[model samples]
Target: MGPPAPGDADDGTGQRTGAVIVVAGVALFATALLAGAALAPDVGAAGDDASGTLVGSHGGGAGLHERGSVYLLDGREIAWRAGDTDSYFDVTKLDNGSVMAGFMQSGYDECGPYESPCAHTGFRIIDPNPDSGADPEITHEYSFPVRSEKNSEVHDVELLDSGEFLVTDMDRERIFTVRGDEITWQWNASQRYDAPEDPTRTDWLHINDVDVIGEDRYLVSVRNAHQLVVVARGEGVVEVINEGDPESTRGDPTLLRQQHNPQWLGNDSVLVADSHNDRIVELERGADGEWTVAWEIYAAEGVNFNWPRDADRLANGNTLITDSLNKRVVEVNRSGETVWSYNTPEVPYEAERLPEGETVGGTSYADGGGDTTTIGEGRDVPVLSFLLVIVQTAVQTPFWFTEVHVAVTLVSLVAVLVGLGSIIRARVRARR
Candidate 1:
């Protein structure tokens, strides 16, 4: 509605049409996900229009190789219908074979036309019948009030088994849980987070991702704080399971700054996407609350992460990782060797492993530097534009331009009539 937040990147050198086409593909790729511990049915093989699967039975190399990454699985990557946008922020799968993708519009700092980008309010739901050819639609948009004011956004979404949802509000620096449509609980960093104000200003907790570690414990990633904070569920006590002080770290000091997503592996250990450090670290907590690194992937330089966002451990011990900036998903065995890999059609956010070996992921990108739209803002055009995508996917139509052209023609006809009426009135007045 108003001007988009500043500090957004828009070179304004690219073509609008090409950007839209690529954005559409990326949006579709973002909806796929990691099925639970069990393997998912091969929807792509069934010849369903909307169903697309990525099987990773390709590539090979023996040693702890780096250059020649092997793809051992035969994965299928299918394009979803048009207008399906993606995110690199959050991914939540529902019990009914549906998914809630956090971050409605991503990548762009500003908004305009089809290029409107917002924070985490936007989401897409995928049906169990992937072949139903139903395009995933974006809806149930949610955003924090202050975030919207400051142009901040949501970083992730977690679906609780109780049908509730938890989201990381980046701007507010807190975690919020939603029941039905209301915010049930929140943990604010400014007031409750324990930290020395002036000394650790650069390391102040910038809550990024949250995961349920136990009935009484929750794991959260604090980017700027440079720590994996373990907090009691529904309580205010926060303890650091990773780095404490910036000076006493084994690696770079910036590692504690702007850390990304974290996943709980078990009671005493967790996996974190240390984005700033360009690696994933497995941290273990001892009885005395001391933390140590158990194992780390790509900790040293020369590893391939561009900006890994989120990761999950599969039943078969494979780790499905979202390489956000690289626009790809890497599947690695327990030994940290690449077992399978899938390139995102565009920039991606989060990824998960499904019941079967297949992995679903969220793609992302910055939109144009023009008008960006959010929920309750922008012209009704985006609403209608998105609805058309739904119809096109449902009907399995190949030509979107044909449908748009007809709508434009009809609107132009009405404008012509209005103009003719005004011209006749001017003639009548001149005669008088």
Candidate 2:
């Protein structure tokens, strides 16, 4: 006949059939839930190897067209870049054909109580072309030391002709020049503008860029302030190019909202990536001393830009744009025609077209060594890692739990019931 009933047991002691199954189900359920959650992908983790070809019609002159590889801050991969720091903020091509980058890590106590929570922020100049089988050489390195109570993270760095470095200190609301380890010049935002409403606001000015416009003048993009300020090295603030109030966008073309990369385009005109406005505007100061939009590119003109963060005027009068949210870098001509484009696997913060004949990692692309061999078989979503991230985030920061976590939990519950049923049947058969 069939196996023994639930109550039957070889030891002569009747099994607690209901309790055993219930407990087994609960235990299995818990285990599966944790396992699944642990296996989920980590969204903050680095992305896979760069893949995809450059698209669009690449025309323009010998130097106007993008000849060399472009440098970018791959947002997704910066967190866990091997042998590197926590985050990559900016990447640019140095005059010596090297790559200069800014990186930062958090949760360090070296800066002490006066500084922000993050530490180990620094900039490095890397040799993109190294010997065969050799790693990229870091020729120059400088980590920000805690010199003042205003220790902050660096977002942008430019090597000055005088062998000095200009850097933006986000937390300190200042742009400072560093000669070796000492701060030679600095301009604090608080000294000129009102402090942000929130006293703890570290990114009040959100100074994203500091470009030397003239002998002693600097063009600064005060993102949070929704304006561009031109400051003299010693004389202090000189001009403020207001882009209107960030809260309300007026029809005035002069007003900017959350802009970045204000570069002098010559003839008293400025080219800015009007980020929040979803356009790139060329502002020109007329004889009336008022700034007006000379030209612009918007989605309505069949041009697609998703929160572009950086735009550089190329030698051929073309523009290289870092389409941040689109996860791509695009080069467009003066007529708003897309000439060249590279689609990244993750968000790209900035894109700098390297000088002619300059390449990174021996390739003129962002493929990180021209090895397009798919990493992890070209899987876009790390499902297993995401599950683990979800579980960990749920446990550590419950507020981070999302609908995906709920779905995983429900699936685990079903698995628990199935496990319990199988165990009950197997135990009954063994008793017989």
Candidate 3:
């Protein structure tokens, strides 16, 4: 009722008010600190944050598309992995246990000024042993050059026995052999097919695979052209196996649409992944010069295949299929029974079995142990660090103000008020 003055000796309410103010200030300071820590940027481990262990899908069901890490299976057990997974096109284990993988990344450019504008398309040979930790090491890397407006993304890279690198350049529609930084032998698709008005505008052919079949002969898959063309090393397109409209069906089985990975089976027979048709067809050339399907495998109830991309015939007469959209790699016997299978995190482009005696610790560098060197982990969002520093400064400013100026000012104000109240009380008592 406006009766309690500053010197209210009757109630002692002034002391209680000061105590509440101090408690509230402390609570606010503690809350600010906790919030700052909670909002700090996360800094994870170095050397490829994308790698991890492969986990099984729920219920272990077949054909269930679940995301997991990429791995190589040896009798249902993981033999080795880069400990990281990527949207890799072709992953092959060499005789020396080194792994070569071809992959693409969007909006990335690693080319120099004079070089072609690369669209983050490259291959890397991963060394699992590096006298370091378990993390794999990248020993060699090659980025495809983009000379035109078209993307220079490559689909397959084969380390040839002749010490040459055979790669498929989809953007240019060419198969070129690289030997020591030079294009030794090149085959242009435009030489055989009509060149687009804008070489950069058309992925016209979409040449996916280039397999060196024999002396001066290469088997290529022209997906958009809907044909398997055999091109001679020096000569042009020597043979067109399935040259026709992709929409129309041909031979005993239908034609291949958007197909990939045309592998040559001996005796003039070819095995190909008829991607859009959802089947693997093995074609054999008859004496009459007509191509006929010798054997074919289609998706069934349990052994389902969705957009199968790559099919390789193994030595034991089994086919290894990379079921792309379904997120699994399966090996089926001649009877089409699922003999072995492995799941992948993303759409698997191609998977191949390594030669025998190649295991996780089978590398020559394995005896060097893991390397202990630490590379600086790159920050995902650099601006977050700056923002955090600003917040930290703001939080500390209050504490500094309280300790250096506010605390002194409050103490002085309290003393002055108390002295004034004492004087007023003395005056009132004297007046009484």
Q: How accurate is candidate 3 locally (lDDT)?
A: 0.57
Residue 375 lDDT in candidate 2: 12
Clashing pairs in 3: 51-83, 51-84, 131-369, 131-370, 131-371, 132-370, 132-371, 133-370, 133-371
Query: Distance (Å) between predicted and true CA of 182, model 2?
Result: 0.6
Per-residue lDDT tens digits of candidate 1, residues 78-109?
43322333222455545665655544333454
TM-score of each model, paired residue for residue: 0.55, 0.59, 0.60
Ranking of all candidate structures by their lDDT, best first:
3, 2, 1
lDDT (0 to 1) per candidate: 0.48, 0.56, 0.57
* lDDT, model 1, position 204: 43
TM-score of the candidate numbered 3?
A: 0.60
Mark the 10 consecutive residues where model 1 has the least summed lDDT.
63-72
Prediction 2 global C-alpha lDDT: 0.56
Model 3 Cα shift for residue 406 (angstroms): 67
